[model samples]
Target: MNSQIKKHQACYTVADYMSWPDDERLELIAGQIFDMSPAPSIKHQNITGEFYSQLKQKLKGKSCVPFIAPVDVVLSANDVVQPDVLVVCNPDKITEKNIQGAPDLIVEVLSPRTALKDLREKKLLYERSGVQEYVIIDPLEEYVQRCWLQNDGHYGASEIFGSPEALALQSLPEVELPLWEIFGLEPPEPAIIWSG
Candidate 1:
């Protein structure tokens, strides 16, 4: 753990988190503060926007609503995260202040600064908090990894998809995201067959 993070671990709470300046982007997990700094790259922003756009278009007028980042999802007093993209199916969790419970789906676009934490710490947090689906996109690699909560109350192994494939979301059956479009990649050409 970073020395600064070590100092804040098991010491900070949501109250302290709320008292911070608006410009400071931080996530609290198990009472530890993780800084979201340096801003994301243009590629990262584009990918995040594409994912949100697709979710918004698919979920329009539906009970499930999609949200972009900077929205607090309060899993507990000591656990709050702002996923890059998220979907909440229950209206009650959508509060004027922040989401009070787990979202149905959470997406995090990996950045070099936060990739390991997103894959390990945040993954465990979402699993224990009962998030139904979690997606991690790597803009550099142009691939996505997804996991869902299993009946055993833990996340199953991640299912990986490349840019050419589409991801069918488990939380919302009707929603499928084109990975190529999301990653800003050219879609694979259709296969041709010779007539017999």
Candidate 2:
């Protein structure tokens, strides 16, 4: 241990994260800064795109707003995160810079590098911030796990959904979608061989 070596402190606030120059892909978790991985895989994008497409059609003229990734969701001044998908009905809450307050729904598409963080860190943050619903999307297993914030806590009454089931949301009642559609990928063909 060298006396001159000093560890860099983690960022705990949205302002702390936003202060950095562009090109830093990071998220603030309960006053801690975690470096995010690169872009998502093709499968991740496909599902996100598919879900966004459906939500757009279903949520038309509705109060529930459907938004995709790259949009900052500020849980608090000190806690700002960019969830994969977020819906905010309060137009007044949507600020010119970022989401000023908690949204109705927060969605996260899990990746290899972000699985643990998404399941634990992000989940805790969303719950504490009062997000109505938090969705954890796993493209690897083609599953979408929805975590409803009940009793002001997380990981309770969480629903894990798989194929043949449609996603239902209390915030967006018009959201009607099938599992196969969200994957938006063609199934593998049955193995066959030329028989004599």
Every candidate's CA RMSD: 2.5, 6.3
User: lDDT per residue, candidate 2, 1-196, as tens digits?
Assistant: 2222223765356666776655656676777766675788988888888788888888889877788888877777677788888889899888888888889988888899888999988888888888888888899888888888777465477898885577888667667678778876554455689999
How would you encode candidate 1's per-residue C-alpha lDDT over 1-196 as one tens digit per residue?
A: 2333345345788887787777678899998888898899999999999999999999999999999998999999899899999999999999999999999999999999999999999999999999999999999999999999999989998999999999999999999988999998898898898899
Candidate 2, residue 88: Cα displacement in angstroms equals 0.5
- Runs in model 1 deviating more than 4 A are 1-9, 194-196
Assess each prediction's global lDDT (C-alpha) against the native. Answer: 0.92, 0.78
How many steric clashes does model 2 contain?
Answer: 2
Work out the TM-score per prediction: 0.94, 0.85
Candidate 2 residue runs with Cα over 4 Å from true position: 1-7, 152-155, 185-196
